[model samples]
Target: MEEREITIVKGKRSTPFSRGILAQTLSQAGAKPELAHRIASEVRAELLAEQRYTVEEEEVLARVRDKLIKKDALVVERLDKWRILRESTEPIVVLIGGATGVGTSTLAADVARRLNIQSVIGTDSIREVLRHAISPDLVPALHKSSYAIKPEDIRIPVKEENTTLYGFRIQASQVAVGVEAIVDRGLKEGTNLVIEGVHLVPEIILDRYRDHPNVCSLVVYLSDEAAHRSRFYIRALGTAMRRPAEEYIAHFGEIRQIHDYIVESARRMGVHTVENFSIENSSDAAVEIVANRVSGIAEKAARRPSSLLLDASARGG
Candidate 1:
């Protein structure tokens, strides 16, 4: 008893025993094997009472089947089933970019909600997070670089929920890094990602992963002249007026130029273009269009490579 770790079996006091010793005694007792198994199960349950284990039984089974197929442990039919299951489970990645005040953020939120994705990342949030890595003095300049309003003139609303504006400016490099982090995380977790911003596009964010099988990046340009002008005017009169008129005017042109550049670049890159302005009812129509296009893209991506390979093999044959 002194040399070995011992525990007193307190249940029913059938016999005084240690933990391991009790298990042996229970097995050897004149109890039916099934009864003894039940007793052992009960004892184990009691011992683990304070700990909690969440077992998703279906997910576990699927994973086990997948592993078997990967390892060639299953029959041909079962292996085919596992392969189909694995292909169907791969996730989708969507990047939505448009000019400012084009409802990109709002549309992204709606799409994410429709998809039941609770984790949503905006470009502004990513910018704020990367602010710490930027130089303090250079941050103000960086902020001004992308905007018509001077850093000093812009007074962000002082509210608990509006703290996303207080951080340092995010440079292009920083924005690219943040986008990659979010996109990579989403793909790895088998979850969908909606990245909305003016800067999200190829040669910046999506180009890095152009070859990835699970990634789908679409450039949505809101191209209604009247709506664009109206929104621009409203924004200009609201928070943008804090800056000098000349500075504000200068930024307006710059933003417009950037928007045109993005549209042209998207076309050149062959990214799917959705004309949000043409839709009769913008919000609802935008959501419907996004859902349809995204689903279609996902389906195409899942099948395109296989089809291409099959065609190539047929040609070779």
Candidate 2:
């Protein structure tokens, strides 16, 4: 039997059928790799068997969705949500918050990969920028730790019952101003972003974005303090800078206090949360959470009329 290939038709233009695009759509819909590949291959065979030399782009998607629906109903739902994300007019913003050792950076990097969003910013980076902008002598709060902070140095109020906690909140507040500015730019430019770091506390950062349809926010924690400490050891080896295991352990009390504050605030804000025992599961959970929040805007985006050939160059033909 001679083999055949299908070209996807878009308006007046056409391109070869891309198995990669079908497989990616399936994977984004939460299908396991083996399953997504199997479905994509199956869909390709079915369409080509129809003997159509050229196929409409919508028809291509329909065939892929039909195969997915037969395999698992939930995947079809996920596909629709994934489609919404792809077709959205507004850029998606994912905010991940946690204390120093809780894997916020790891989770953000992974989620950014899954979502295909190019911009990922750490709040620490934001802080560093602010530091260069202002003098440490003037804004001492910007120069120091949330715990053991000298009130006179940073202008933190000593009268607060928990000055350590108050100081941490103040530090987060300073960094969040920069966070919001970056987020606003992404939103205005329609570029998806993933932002993670300690300073992204719920009250300071998550609360403002929670009500936005284009935003997905999560706070992660290490339920086991001992396990949390171990992450620094593994992290130090991966990066150029040595992890400050001793400094962090010495101030574990302050860090833990900030962790508790974030968890409590996330609870109140009704944002999604992850416990960082397993990075794989935590990353998966974040994708699902982001999908749920972005679903509302998907259909509206999908209904939009377009003349561009969005799938003409999807991976391989």
Candidate 3:
């Protein structure tokens, strides 16, 4: 017997139902990946047993919801919220800020994949572009690593701020120009983006967009010094030793200083901070924060009067 393929219909579109796609969606909405795959497989089996060849998207969602609620109600709520975020009119922007070796870039990529965001950029790339346009002599801090600013390159001498922080701020402030431009372009084009790097200092790049409904920012940090150092070794291996871990380890003090500064700034600014000891745990925490932020925006929009919503939409909010 030739088995029939299940077709899912949504509005004017019809596509083949895929357990892999459903599982990915479920995993993205806060469900454990293994459990998500199990649930997806079960859903497929149920449909096959019922001999249902055609189904509405809502029906599939309802079935998945029923199954998901039995195993975990919280994740089911997140799945609903994820759908709301998808239906939102504004583009999503996520800024991930952290010290070097704390895994901001890795977390940013993971979060982008979970949310299906197409644009992923790093602040380092922005800094590189700035280096080409600006002369090292003109802005010495811009040319050095955020954590490796030479004493002579320290242009700002704030009495209260330490030399390490002062140098980082000088470099980050210059990079902030590029970060802001990318953010503005994403907003204008309604393109979702994930921008992560040490240069995304909350006070520098986040202050302007922090209040925007579609913009969510968070900091990732490693609280334990030993674990933080280990990340550099792991990164070096991953990069085929092209970026020597010894170089980063040699400057661990400066890196940890910047780490503390960023973490403190996050706390002061009321931005969420994820202690990144484990990738899986940190990823869940990061995704939950983003989901909550998006869901809150969706709820507020839902409560507004249609006229106000329309007015806000027309104004490109």
Candidate 4:
């Protein structure tokens, strides 16, 4: 009559039944933690009533789906997505890129919080760090604002749009070295990070993580120039004490040029783009883009799995 007397048959072998696996599958399907546990508890009773020593893995899957169908019809797709999220062993890296005033900082913060990731870094912070380590005499671009960098240093002809693009790209390249280093370290440590900043351009990030299934890159932009300019106005009013937002306002044209350049590069390179017309829409789009990219942990851990197997000590939370 003891619990250990029951076994679940799985592909030519049987093991002591554990509801941990059931709860995990249900949780991945979008069941809340408490509900997942309650569902698993109820299902275990149903399985025992069969009065069999072993139940097929396929049968278990069927029962799990049935329970979900009764709970809510909409969760089927959510379940499929969660299944991949549950099974993937790799850390998730989300890189968000945008021009100075496109609101990516806010979007990235929300997405990171929603994803439950602990690391959120702004590339502007990276630029500030580089300024301390490198001298202006060595890297003049590092010392000047990307838009305000004197044309005397630029080798290219100073066409208005091209001039700004060229200047920003130079500063971006210098900052990119630090960004890539952080990414490399995170990959080795198996820690997830959400890095948001202007320097996370499609051109640079694509080179580093395009082939990496665990990393997703996104570029945010605003189609309406007037609205984009308004963002700078609102920002200036709030932080009037420290830095004058008017400088950004005065250089708005140059900022838009860089924004366009980045968007074009993202399109050419096939990096995902989210337009920040509204915060809710942009945030929802960003999360879905990431969820779509994460492969199932269960699928990858299925073959003689160690950590992902049905061990009660393993935390599915």
- Assess each prediction's global lDDT (C-alpha) against the native: 0.49, 0.78, 0.83, 0.75
The model with the greatest TM-score is 3
- Model 4: which ten-residue window has the lowest total lDDT? 303-312
All candidates' TM-scores? 0.50, 0.83, 0.91, 0.70
Model 1 lDDT tens row, 37-91: 4444454454345232332223323433343344334222332332232234456
| Per-residue accuracy of model 4 over 1-317 as CA lDDT, tens digit each | 56535666655555676777667655544456687787778877887776766777667666767877887655556655544554456777889999989999889887765455678999989999999999887777777776677666565568764667777888899999999899888878877889998888889665579878778899999999999989987877776536677888888878888899889999999999999988767876787778777654425644333222245344331
Error of 4 at 302 (Å): 7.7
Lowest-lDDT window of 10 residues in candidate 1?
308-317
Worst 10 residues of 2 by lDDT: 308-317
lDDT of 3 by residue, 160-258 (tens): 437778989989999999998998899899788999999988788777787887889999998999999999999988877566999999999999999
Regions of model 3 farther than 4 Å from truth: 155-161, 299-317
Clashing pairs in 3: none
- Comparing 1 with 2 on lDDT, the higher-scoring candidate is 2
Model 4 error, position 36 (Å): 16
Candidate 4's C-alpha runs over 4 A off are 1-87, 155-161, 237-241, 296-317
Q: Which order, best to worst by TM-score?
A: 3, 2, 4, 1
Pairs of residues clashing in candidate 2: none
Greater-lDDT candidate between 3 and 4: 3
Q: Flag clash pairs in model 4.
A: 84-296, 87-296, 87-297, 87-298, 88-296, 88-297
